[model samples]
Target: MSKIKQFFVRNKKKILIGLGVFLGLLLVAFAIFFLNRERLLQYAVKKVVQKVENRYPADLQIGKAQFKGLATVLVTDISFVPENQPKLLQIDTVEATVSVRSLFLGRLVFKQFDVANGDVTAFKQDSVDNFSFLYKKKATGEEEKTKDAKEKSNYGTILNRLIETAFENVPDGVNFRNLGVIFQNNGRTISMRLPTLTVEDGQIQGRMAITTDSITNTMYVNGVIDPDEYLLAAKMYAEKAGGIQVPYIQQKFGATMRFDTLSLSITDKVFKNDQLTITGESSAHGLVLNHPKIADEDVFVKNGALKYVITLGNHYYSLDTLSEVRVNKAVFYPQLTYETRPNRKIGVKIDSPNIPANDLFESMPPGLFDTFQGMRANGSFKYHMDFYVDMAKVDSLTFNSDLDGQNLEITQFGEQDLRKINREFEHTVYENGKPTRTFLVGPSNPNFTPYNQISNYLKNAILTAEDPRFFTHKGFHEGAFRHSLITNIKEGSFVRGGSTVAMQLVKNVYLTRKKTITRKVEEALIVWLIENLNLSTKQRMYEVYLNIIEWGPNIYGVKEGAQFYFSKRPSELTLEESMFMASIVPKPKQYRTYFNQYGELRAYPRYFFNLISGNMLKRGLISPSEHASVSSYVNLNGRAGNFIMAKPDTTQIMDTLQLAPIDLLDF
Candidate 1:
């Protein structure tokens, strides 16, 4: 015990020195951290920017930035320049205050954001280059929300957020204090003010107080709208224009409508008098109407004359007339029409006993078609003042004249003919070398289809072509791989592949269409991963495949392909047609050159159809009767000159088919 105490005393000096050195090092570390705080923050910001750019790409550029440790807020000045546009759409120069408390919560608790005092400038371009700041994409569940810096867009994702945010409830759950909007066009400007508004799920609910008076027209608007329904209604509103020839009216109109402070309520109202109690909104930029549920029968049909009120700017226009009114009510009565003469002239006539001819003509303003400037209107009335339209102003005249009541009874006037005006149809071919002109359907095609059918067809096709035993085999096709390598070596070039359908689906959906073995190999791996993923739905897979598949030369989708070749819907394809379609699954363009004068299919490419169908039958994929039907119909020809543009009943035909699966090894 005495020796131990003596040793401790001797080492006391050394122990004190060691403690002093440790304290000195700790102080030095603190000094460094405090001195380089700004540089550290700058570095952090740069790293954040890099990460954001990697995740969410956009044409984003940041200028000056300021961070206050005390307030825990970051102020950044930003400029947004959309891709392909040299002009800047927005510039925020003021302080963008963010809550430090929210940041801490975002880091460890919940994700919430607040923006204060962000000075921004928004630009509206010509018809070709308008700026849109909304993100209208489907939200997936796997998104990460805890990142310090997230990628964003000014026109795309940002706009989408703003739209979604507009419907987001106020944090404190308070009704809006004010909502105001000013719409400007040419020399005319209209303003709408709503002091009180409430935001809820996809709806802005408030009374809009409006007042407007022009030289020739005046309107007052006092109504409530449900913004979500209004959005749907706006889409339907433009569609209601049906055959009207207007230049991007749907896109241009929404920019003028501002609903941040106003709540829109959409409702369906039964009729009372000549008014409709419409509750829903049309779309972003559209006129407000009463809820449909409260629609008045009298407004639709009243003593042979339609009477209704329209709110524009701030005043309401009470209109009662029998003809020549551009409003939709005038056309809903069914037989009403405005015909433009062929001589670049204008005239008005009505065929209603209750509606006096003088009142009808007087109700319509002269040179109404003049607003459509470049388009000219010419022609004289027929025996009963029924005018013949000149080609120049035909589109404008159609717009000003509602198609609802007027059928515009020009016998043999097919609605499909209008597709030619915009070159909506393209020349293409189907199996059996049949040539045809097909319509280009946008996302709004009328075909009713579930997503699965298209996905399965694509999956099966790829599997059959690449690896027949995809379902039963593991990720790799060993036999197919060896065969492919040997065959390539023997041929002295890449001649075949052994990728499965799952792989092809992955390639088509996510990767580029490069014809290389490297890409194919990567695609195969991706396919295995995707198939194993629980996210892939049968319908979703088929829908994507159906859209991406090349059904013919410049033709895509079963809907368009079926319609193009046979002038029939997808459901109407016969057994022979199905076999023909399946036969051409390997190559689309090889048999796309056999069409009649009217762009109708005149023959089928028999070689591929016969070869594939025969093989499928021999492998027991199809029964004897199914094989017989397909063989008999493969090369049959229709009567010459009997082809016409007509819709055929599809339901009965698709139901009549008794198809069989092809053997896996036949291909």
Candidate 2:
């Protein structure tokens, strides 16, 4: 012990000197770090801000940064709030943490992160406006309060801030923990309520998440949210206006609408239910308040009130309201069932009987329904729908509803907020008048009209012109097809089509109308399947045919042709108007010149129309006296002025079985 002590005493001076040097080096390093800390953090934050600006091009600023270790960096209060900006939005707070491992490497490696609290406020002046996060720079002398007030009140500012924090270019190969969001806008609020949020690359996952109730002030979504899986659900709603309704019917249906472009996707997990059920409804305003069957009854109300109650066996729930109706506040009750691998059955139900119909209608935004004429109706109805799902997709959905069928008094939800309504109406009018109208018509028409009326006209006209043997055949009319096929083979160039109406429907719906044997086989197979299933009749075949048939440049359907050629309704066509419309059935443009100059074609197709009508008369398709009168009235170039008709063709005529496509195209 004495010898060791003597050795230690001898080396004490050397050890002291070494220790002193080490302490000096440590002090120097810390001093250098502290002094340059501002610049270092400035460079980093500036670079990040610049990147975000380049992408989003917005007003962005990062709070002063603090570092604890060589690796741990914290940005305390970052914001992307804009001032004097019309387009850009703002956010409240954004916090970021750098991973400890990649400190000196000059690359972002985020292993753990905490985004404690944030708020987003978004706004747009109108539905037609595109949401922009960048604001225009304005004069500096602008009123400070006005500028600040605009920024503060602007919800877009909050949106921008939240986007930067949540979606900034995070480093690869890093883990995340506990990310959350809480936002509110009047009647609605969203709490991302993620107890744990993990993210790596493009993959994101969350646990114990909840989406609060939008209408009845309840939480609609509560469970683990896998961005990848829940994304699909989000996508379904994103594309469609009304996402999904749980309860079949209530006082009013609740739904969300998208008037602008937005995209969302699932990240990692899927939507599931320990016990699951879904209900949905789609009703137009006319169906709700103006159907002829219920039009005359008490519809408009000075005092609008609605109420509903449901009793599922023993459980019961009730809803009440006293005003206009919004289309989404219905409740959904799920009956959940389970099954084992081989063959087992288990059933479960989630039920809600109390749905407030009046409350739903009253919750509608001002001016949703601006005005009404003698409309009065207020009552509550209840409906139930159950879904049977095996694994994922629905197996069956059974819907049942009891419409209270009460005398309802209807009135505008909002007093004549005419300014908004007029603006919308004017925009729609301008859009319809634009050259874009041609785009709407397209090569095939999407004309909105009853399917039955158009079908009857096209069928009779086709049979009057083409083949009379359309209905008796399977996919092909054996006698007519054989005869036409022989003639086409002899001619070397195709002059006629033996295609039946069924074949035409098949070709139009399932396959392209290519004049080739391969396409023909496909068309035939589709036709065979449609016929074999016995799903459609000859009249239905014609309806489908006219819907997809090309009538002219950017025109389709018999109704469209009737309007385009005659400027009249299909039912209002006179005998000559009918014949003139039918004359072009073979080739719409081939005979368009006949009517382009007010029915001026004094030549070929008209002569054929008369011949075909004459043959039909001989075949008892039309009365002789009627045929004689129609023939006498024919002025191939005749104007159908003041030609009011008695009745449109009916289904009985469609079922006559003699009219065929061959007869229509033959002439």
Candidate 3:
């Protein structure tokens, strides 16, 4: 103790000097912080906002920045532009509290961020929409460019691609208060009532009510993102607010669909252009969807429970084939696929467990099969549909199916049945799927003919030309479906029907002619119903189809077609005439122009007729005698039909001169 006292007495002045030096350094630090505080706050906030606003094509700014508490900053006059929008969004003020210790290390570590009272207006123009751009970049171009390059080299699973889009630089927490969003597009506006939206950790949850087109619904959604952190903050909010109250809205298929309750489990890398798998359950109630091209009597899902897993790929931007889906209590697997170059295939497969016929019917919107729903149905059935495509050529578009059970029942009729077959089914205004038109082809036209009255040659020719596998297939064929699928994908349009007799019958009888998705879906449903219900015998269905199908200008039935073209009864038509019938079936009106100035059929018609004859013979559809009789000459002036004579052997005949048949499956 004595030695310590002596040392202290000797160094009192030196100790005082050291203390003054330390105080001077502290004062300088305080002075620098006070002088540059605004600049630091602005730098930190602007950096973060810019990162968050990268997806928005607008300007964002803050004004009147000032210090609040020791580590809190208050920024006023926050605005996001362009300012001329009818629903401009203006945030009156924002407060950010950061970690003071982090500031000392030159890092901006946010503790809490809050945005209060934001008012936003959104509207659409005739040619453009304000929110349209929001999703325009849904696929990030830069990220995509890099990803494409990587795909070329790696071309792995979609999950690999998803990994390329990594999510980083996420915020600790963000809060919004009194936010309002109104959207107007195409003279229709939807308003969203979202009192608050908060994003923290790895979850994006909200509850909101949205109204548009005089319909409203409340949506509640809770989703887990970035499963890697699912455990960290899983219970963080339990101690504070049990749950957040959020309001939001979603637009799908150009329509507003409501979700009463939605629980989602999705990976966090979605925004990063990486692989995304979303598993969710939804409860929907009485929601009538609206689309610009949708019918006024738009279909609605009243109430239902659904659970689904959706997966997306990076290269083809297509859905994966392995996914589970449930509606009500029924379970099904739906797969949509897009392949790369050389293969270039697009396909869809729906596999469902056997289900009750009425239950299945009731689950789907009745209007989808308004005409077919009247058919009596009983029993349970399961089916698999394979829409095969080869996007390399124009010929291979096939929609094939296999039905496991016969659960439908149909009533029979006499010749009067032919009259009922003539009813005009719903038809499309065009192939665009908007605005439907009723094609009145029947209600029992006088030209209708019974199955027995129709010529067997015409039947064989139509079967061989349209669908050789029609009798064996339920709705579509296997080889043809695969081939046709490819062709459709290549053309990027439904130019080719790639349909079987059953599908064609449903289309001509119960749906519009438009090539839109709606028509196709309706056509599929009706075909399924008819086939499963056995609404009519195949023979009767064919009779009805021939009677209702469009033949030419003002010509609706085969009877009218037979009298108009050959001036004879269907039964009296010869084999050559039958081939002509089949050839012109696709373009009956165009066939009328094939006659020369002399008023006789042209060489082009004879050529196609002969081609189909050879095809029929090769397929063993026609006997040798029938082939000979039909191939005798052309009908230009009572000549038989056209043929390329050579060795009689089937194999030898095909080896010479590439006869190149008319290709009925050709567009």
Candidate of highest lDDT? 3
**Tens-digit lDDT string for candidate 3 (1-667):** 6998988899999999999999999999888987887677767666657754785666677777778977787879977674334335677887878775665554567667787877677778796655434323334688887755554433334343334333333456667776677877777778877666676665555555567656554555444445343221211111122122222233435544433233333322332344455444444444444443443245555455444455544445444455656554456777887766555777788888888766665566543334434433467668787775565644646676776765444343211222244344333333344543334444444565777888988888887777766666566555554554454455565434457788887766556564555566666666665564555567777877787665555566788777766777888777887777776676655654555554444566556667677777887878888777765342432211121122222222221112211124422
Cα RMSDs, all models: 29.0, 22.3, 11.1
lDDT of 1: 0.37
**How much is 596 displaced in model 2, in angstroms?**
25
Clashes of each: 73, 74, 37
lDDT order, best first, reads 3, 2, 1
Among all candidates shown, the one with the greatest TM-score: 3
lDDT to native, each model: 0.37, 0.43, 0.58
Which scores greater on TM-score, model 1 or model 2?
Answer: 2
lDDT of 2 at 440: 26
Candidate 2: lDDT of 513? 34
TM accuracy, model 1:
0.27
Q: The CA-based lDDT of model 2 is what?
A: 0.43
Worst 10 residues of 1 by lDDT: 653-662
Tens digit per residue, CA lDDT, model 1, 226-299? 43432311111122312112222224542111111111232432223322222232222222212122221111
